[model samples]
Target chain A: MSDFIEKFSSISLNDIKNVPESDFPELTAEEKALASQAVTYSNRIEDADSISNLNDSLRNKTFIVGNKPSKADLLVFEKVFKVASKWSSVEDVSKHRHIIRWVDLIQNTLVNVPESEKLKVSLDIEVPREIKE
Target chain B: MVVTLTVAAKAPLVPYGSLIATEFVNRSNGDGKIDLQVVDQKSVDSADANSASKLTTSDGKEIKGEADVLKELGKLFPDVLQEVSKSQDLIDTAQNNLSIKNFKELATHLEKLDAHLNFRSFMLFHKCTVADIAVWGVLRANALMGSIIKNEVYVNVSRWYNFLAADERFDAAIQNFTKSLAELKKSEKLSKGKKESHKA
Candidate 1:
């Protein structure tokens, strides 16, 4: 099954509809629209302003929803990471400090050595260039 | 004055209606002058109907559409009347500017809203006004703009959107919408099943 369907299979429809917590409210209608927009927008074109705006908004934030990395934060992190990676001329992520901090915290601190090490093999990812140097 | 608003749960304008009702209730704060009743049309209609979106006054005058209902509320209350009009204008501009075909126009409108929201927490000076309600409602209702807010595409606008969204009143309103929509969908599925059985 699709990633979406697999996720859906685990949750009840009632669970799907309700924004059950103080954490991330179930994706509101607007969030759904934004998701569609984000997917479509990314498929067709890249918007640098979107990346910059996300980075600007995250200036003081530790995570997207809370201090810890939630699924919402990870989803946003992945999307913004895609945009940040596309900035051709920037030698490193110095300009996008918030994003780098978030990604590092998730990969190095949140995920344990084995998991991150496995991710490294699959993703072939290095510490963000700034952190590496 | 008791004002009951009947709103279609699936309508794109539903969020605005909910926000208006929530804001009105908050502003009233059990003063007993303004008793706001919000009715979901999903229970009454087999299918969602925009015409069911109306506001009935205590005197029994039915007002229709987001603009009309908001306008009447402004007339009756007169407290946030100017703010209501300003909010509607901002909503109109934001709604009009959302276009997949025209990225430049969308960016321009986004920047304009971002700048407008830069220093202001609410659309108005300090308090959350109808302008914030209408714009946030409309933006949230729009799928693309909703994503923009969800993703925090514009820093100031995202900050402001998150603030209003965090309001318990807003959360309650959204919960009601979610329940009503789910119920409507369930009913729709059952009805479809009945039809299929009859055909079989």
Candidate 2:
């Protein structure tokens, strides 16, 4: 079970690195097409600048929804932190007040396991390089 | 306003929550749209499980239990379930609760369940409806667990996962989530190996 959860955690992280236009690998035909469509859809709803701003604003709080913490934050936090750390562009955008507050909330309140233990579990796993393009 | 289903941190429903939201939204036909909101349920203090249980939908609808949702979705979207069952290896790799020998049996049952989904004249609606999204979430979580175990048998499942990952909307929301998980583990490993080297 721990193995499964650990692996799940790793896969989630890998997915963050696979996003379009993050200096990650170029998208395959399908990914590119899908990404283009999403960009269009997102654009139709709101501009990139606004979306970026929204993300920045949302980052600082300890909770993403409701008066208390929820699972959605756990799933999203791991990825947001990774993206913010790995990509300079993402980091720049994530440095907004909301994002910082949210991250701080997660860091201070949400984290249940010891940081060292988490780091240890993460270190034990091996990441495969050959993710399908 | 769009109706969204946000998950709490450490909630068991996190894996399948978005898929369920997608299914609900797809089926709502824009009537009562279901937007997926992934919350950090883990932030809720451990002692607050009872309080967490009381959390409701944006409109105050209580989220259904996992089993109930799965059964309902299974009845609604049989075809998607069939597609998911086709990736047997992926199913086998998700968790150790099930034995390896049960893979074939599970696959067989999944096929039957798929058939049930496809049974058009059986009074249920046709096509991939919101119910399919529910089942899809379960299958997807199982496959995710399998992939992490490095189960080689799940190659076909991997193929299917890649196909889903290629989609922009799905990717936009889920890609970051999965990738961060993978990296967190990797960074831990690198740091640990370094520590061991110093100790040596």
Candidate 3:
């Protein structure tokens, strides 16, 4: 139980935001415009399709860029769960086969962050301690 | 599909969402189009100020900055300012308001936002979609903001941001925004340096 709690506790959302911006340099105006369009289209599609399935699928799947799960997976997974818990519509969609498979995969594969390593990362000060408690 | 686009600006700061929305509309080739509606609040305010100095209100009251404008513009034009204010509110409430100390934490927040946006469903539905474009745009903007700010405490946000930044689709956009931001920062520094040198 402590291990599970620690693993969950160790996962911080802020880590997800910083990694990429640091790696990529600046973009051109045209590129920025295109990227913005791409993201907008992506959201529209999600809204049009099975929002529930999308949310559930996201929760279940590990965001493994290559073979192994990266911090990306953790970043996405946490939000998916948060939203799922928040919205009833999304929770209902979690019943889908693909959604279930994806969530299970994340929980089974990526839930293990060693206790010692977990201690090293700082908890977000803004996050209510009572939530973890 | 017929797409309508609008570009609205209030003042010094362009609402990040509006900026991203405009960028998205511009990027969408023929699939959908945007009609930009630029509401210059600064100009409107200035006009109001000028009018206030000229005459008293019909209600026997002195005009003021926002009040004069509201009185003269009626309900329609004032709505634009209301929208802008709402956007500003979102910015104020943005979760990543804190200056992050660790890169990992930033990455986490970015990823969480990304997931909340739900890009995969967009990909699943339409080959080229607005959601994809919007998410990518916001993510790129966030990346640039994070870089400029230099507080990488949000590991998840940073990691997710990096993932998109490295992707081929976003590579160009990320680079472009970053370059512009970097150039702006450089010019700012150069000007500051020149000012110091002048003082010396």
Candidate 4:
């Protein structure tokens, strides 16, 4: 099982879609690697420890990879966005505030899609975890 | 003319959106001429406009996609299609709301549709065009639409929906779909639909 999991993870990393030049002109290597990483997020998001790593990675960042939206953002968006609406409550959502933020941003900024197509995250209800004195 | 629409040979035939567009055209027209053939889903997608166009008057005019099938059905009834096509956005909006599982958002969307129906008897035109058939058909298919309209939240949408449902053909279309659908074990037909009784 361990061997299978290891091999599976590596295989998923190579599942990244090449962002067409028309979508976002020549992506630097950093963006390309980030896009590849998006493919393995399904695993990362499930592991409690790895999920925190994702949350921390997204703290100050907007997109998952490069500052400009690219295939990486969309790949992660594909994994996370679908389940975001069913997070149960604000507690589950507020725990991943940064992830939620990135998901919402990708939906709106990544593509000039229609309003109905966009996934909405009501950030207002997610109150501060603790008001720092 | 024997109108035939092709969809993939998938199970638990969820008839909404473009998937059921041909059925909508066939049943609403009461012509019973349309034949929904189950072929390889790949062949339907590979059928380009070049080939599909040439198939205009025959036993096998390949429909590129369900939406293309919709446009073909539209061509058969120009005036009805024109009006109903305008209100297709309502179908899309309601579908989105349902997807997110946001009842609040759905009510707001329904309010807008309700407002539209407030002034006019139908969606875009004076008569029940494909617009009424399409919108009403989808909402009836949804499980939650029952309670949402139970108290009649949006009187206009409820009124319009029931008004359209009163047509026996609309009811029959649903009955036919449900009876056929019952044969297949429910796959991930509609995640939203899974929680409720699949009877609808």
Q: Higher-TM-score candidate among 1 and 3?
A: 1
Candidate maximizing TM-score: 1
| DockQ, every prediction | 0.02, 0.01, 0.04, 0.01
Q: Residues A1-133, candidate 4: write the lDDT tens digits.
A: 1011112211122344554434443567876776566557655666776566676666434456533445566566666665666665767766776676666545544434356755565644534332112
State each model's CA lDDT, in order.
0.50, 0.37, 0.35, 0.51
Across A1-133, the per-residue lDDT of candidate 1 in tens digits comes to 0012112212221232342323333565555554444444334325566655555545434445422223444345444544554433333444555554444444443222233332211121222221111
lDDT, candidate 1, at B57: 83
TM of each candidate vs. truth:
0.50, 0.32, 0.28, 0.42
Residue pairs in collision within model 4 = none
> Which candidate leads in DockQ?
3
The candidate, 2 or 4, that scores higher on TM-score is 4
Runs of candidate 3 with Cα error greater than 4 angstroms are: A1-133, B1-12, B22-31, B35-152, B166-200
Query: What does the lDDT come to for candidate 4?
Result: 0.51
The C-alpha stretches of model 1 lying farther than 4 A from their native spots are A1-133, B12-20, B23-28, B31-52, B78-82, B85-88, B94-104, B194-200
Candidate 2 interface RMSD value: 20.5
Weakest lDDT window of 10 consecutive positions for candidate 1 chain B:
B43-52
Residue-level lDDT tens digits of model 3 in B1-200: 33222222333322233333334334534343333334434332354422211112334443332222222222222221123322332232232332233456654554444333232222112122222333333433343465622343332233334433443434543344445556655665787786664674
Candidate 2 chain A has its poorest 10 consecutive residues by lDDT at A1-10
The residue-by-residue lDDT of candidate 1 on B93-158, one tens digit each, is: 644564333556676777767655432334654355566666766666666676666666676577
Clashes of 3: 107
Candidate 4 segments exceeding 4 Å error? A1-133, B6-13, B17-32, B37-61, B64-68, B79-100, B184-200
* Share of the reference A-B contacts seen in candidate 4: 0.00
Ten residues in sequence with the least summed lDDT for candidate 1 chain A? A1-10
**What DockQ does model 4 achieve?**
0.01
